[model samples]
Target: MSVRVQADPNQPQAQDQSFSAAFELQGNPDQGELRLYTPLGSTAAGIQWTPINAVLQAHGETRQFRDLAQLITLVLGTDVPVTALFAWLAGQNQEVDGWQVDLSARNQGKIAARRMAPALPAELQVVLDN
Candidate 1:
């Protein structure tokens, strides 16, 4: 899968960040689905920390989280609502990268951790720096 994120360049905001990232995730792994434009996409399988009931897609792939609450409690071990992760990442303040998958499945909901990546394309970075 090739996942590309087109960030709005303006980050570290005092408000929302959810709309800050524009992501494009597509390829063989995500065929027959509208996986082209999204903030982020990930599967809940192989997540020992947050073992979920899981809702399988048509092509036998897992994406849509089935149990949100149980997933969060298991991953975070706290009572933080799972949506907080999404809410925070979707905001326009935080920019990070190379982060581990932190998802908790509990009674409240499934929360996903925000992982930001450093600005890349060395050539582009240098061009923008000047």
Candidate 2:
């Protein structure tokens, strides 16, 4: 899956900070691992999270977070509705307060979602590798 983040232009601090990345997400939101791959296909970073805490390993260094939300926010620059995401991936159209998700292409192993409220809106696109 690949994710593209678009910082809100209205928020001066968020401008010029958008980024894109491809990654493999495994397990469930409660306890899962997300591995980001480099352009050359090597592992760039790995994030593991559980109910108790979250750990990020990258650049030969390991960092810890109090929870998955904190870890995600730190890495993605915004909070993502991960729980809702799992539901979306499973073909369930779940509604999140500040986000809109589209699963119309789930049969084709594709999903798209966008955050429209608060600040620092972002777009998430996922394509399952079959």
Candidate 3:
């Protein structure tokens, strides 16, 4: 876990900024937690955290994950690259897989379940990758 402190604008149209701290987490496929603290509100999702050899249970079963980034990409469908995903998850610098994964129907278009990649693993990864 890590504390992310930064200036956050209260509203989209507001012209003010405040210091915010987000308790971020990184884990493998099955479990992870992302709890963010801001002056505005709490942004917590994907809280089941794991790592290399991290085991996650979903759909009535337990599974193993490669690393923390892949877990989020699988859960969120970001399709992050192998090299990049590694750098982010392993903490080569200071960022983890960061992206807004909007998997709405129209945006997804004709993308089918078979098309999404290591981006989606087994029944979990490709469900959105396609």
Candidate 4:
């Protein structure tokens, strides 16, 4: 799975830049592995976790974190509800704090989500390549 993120222009700290990344995710929030690939299709980063520990691999190095969220933040520079993402992609709405995912147009291969609570509300629009 992959998503392209855009920050709301109306927000103060919002940036005009957009984020695009590819993901290879499995399992649920509690136990899963997610790998983010570079635009060139190289392995940019990866996160794997279980109840005991979470690890992040990037730049030919591995770092440990207490949870997936922490590792994700460190990697993406922001927090995304990846768990809810699967549900959203399937056209089901899952509650994600500060974020509202809209899949109404999923049939058209488009899905968008907005972060409402953050000071700089951001929008994430995903278009499945498949």
Q: What TM-score goes with each of the models? A: 0.22, 0.88, 0.27, 0.76
> Order of candidates by TM-score, top first?
2, 4, 3, 1
Better of 1 and 3 by lDDT: 3
Q: How accurate is candidate 4 locally (lDDT)?
A: 0.75
* Residue 93 shift from truth in candidate 1, angstroms: 9.0
Rank list by lDDT:
2, 4, 3, 1
For residues 12-79, what per-residue lDDT tens digits would candidate 1 score against the true structure? 54332221122232222112111222344453223211233423233455444445455433332322
Q: What TM-score would you give candidate 3 relative to the actual structure?
A: 0.27
Question: 98, model 1: CA deviation in Å?
Answer: 29
lDDT of 3 by residue, 1-130 (tens): 2111222234455332222243444443344454444446554332354444444454545555667556544544334443433333333332223432222342443111221232222111111122
What's the lDDT of the predicted structure labeled candidate 1? 0.29
What would the per-residue lDDT of candidate 4 be over residues 55-80, giving only the tens digit for each residue? 98899999999888787666655677
lDDT, candidates in the order shown: 0.29, 0.84, 0.36, 0.75
Better of 1 and 2 by lDDT: 2
lDDT of 2 by residue, 4-37 (tens): 6675677678653444567888899889999998
Candidate 1 colliding pairs, count: 25
Q: Model 2: runs farther than 4 Å from truth?
A: 10-16
Preferred candidate (lDDT higher): 1 or 4: 4
